[model samples]
Target: MLFYNDYPLPLLGWGKLRNRFLPDKGKIMTQAIFKATIIAAAAVFFAIFVAVVVPPLIAQPDVVGAFAAGFVNPYASGYSSDVLACWVILAAWIAYEAKALGIRHGWICALLGIIPGVAVGFALYLLLRMRQLKAG
Candidate 1:
């Protein structure tokens, strides 16, 4: 079986390296790095939610009705439907990658993230993937 052992790892890039190898002392460093990334991501998500998503929901006279119109109405549903599909694809991708890297709790974070928001799930996966992605 072919593995990605021969590939060069990027110092700052998380994607490929996180899934491939770990340096001898990678765990401690990865935790610190993941902690920083998670904090930044959480701040961004919260800021966007408070500034953007909240205003619209607050402005809506009938919150349930608004949701129904946006989610159930075919005319307005196309874009959201596509986005939902994308989230599913993202979830599947995260799960598959986590499995391949043997990252413990990665899938759990991803699944939980989906409940609150896909962004949350992504952040959780990123936070929990430090050990798998560490490289010397």
Candidate 2:
């Protein structure tokens, strides 16, 4: 038997040492893909915000007016209403999960949900939730 850092090496095989030191490749790949999807969702939504909103925002610079415009028509009103409802749902879930899963900084996502919209906030919250669950 050999010794490493004052610890005796396994006599059977090196598989135990590799398993103890390295994580599963498949698991790592899956986790990376999952995190990338979440980040990509946020990035795509942010790009949409910049393209669809930034021009008018730069010209008018009226935050309240921009928000009120979301209800300018019946269709717009419906969409805006849905967005608000989703934000409420997201906030409620965040609050519940904070206690149940020990997720923190969820309030920031809730606030972002109202401003930049639900897609970004929902994605961010999912990322945070994944990280917390993985840690546990």
Candidate 3:
């Protein structure tokens, strides 16, 4: 048996580090790290939304024009297209996983995807998925 940080690794070998050493503690640590990453991503993306989108929203409040601005140029259009595609991908995953994993409230993330952006919604979905996985 090998050792890591003074813990004995399982004889089953290198299949899974968490399974090999620190079992429950390792799983907890991994889950905490994953949740923190999701929260951090959501915070950063939401900050960008507030900084860039809120200003124009508060100033003129032109919802249609605000959306149109995303495709104003070739570069913007490309990025906008990518975001739309990503949202579609997320929606599909959400739909499938809701059925497969019995995860609830995924629709809220879908709505968030449209409003604040995909990153926030994606992070929220990940957190939800993590919770459901842990529960099951």
Best by TM-score: 3
lDDT of 3 by residue, 1-136 (tens): 7775567766674677655545654554676788898899899999999998899799999999989998999999999999999999999999998899799999999989998999999999998887888899
TM-score list, all predictions: 0.46, 0.72, 0.76
Where is model 2 more than 4 Å wrong at Cα?
Answer: 1-33
- Residue pairs whose backbone atoms clash in candidate 2: none
What does the lDDT read for residue 109 in candidate 1? 63
Q: lDDT, candidate 2, residue 25?
A: 54
Candidate 3 Cα outliers beyond 4 Å, as residue runs: 1-29
Leading candidate by lDDT = 3
What do the candidate models score in CA lDDT, each in turn?
Answer: 0.65, 0.87, 0.88
Candidates 1 and 2 compared by lDDT, better number: 2
lDDT of 1 by residue, 1-136 (tens): 2323444555565676556555444444665676887778877886786687677777876756755665776767997677567678777777787568766666676565544456677676776665567841
Off by over 4 Å in 1: 1-38, 47-79
Q: How far off is residue 76 in model 2, in Å? A: 1.1
* Descending-lDDT candidate ranking: 3, 2, 1
Candidate 2 per-residue lDDT, tens place, 104-127, comes to 999999988977889999998998
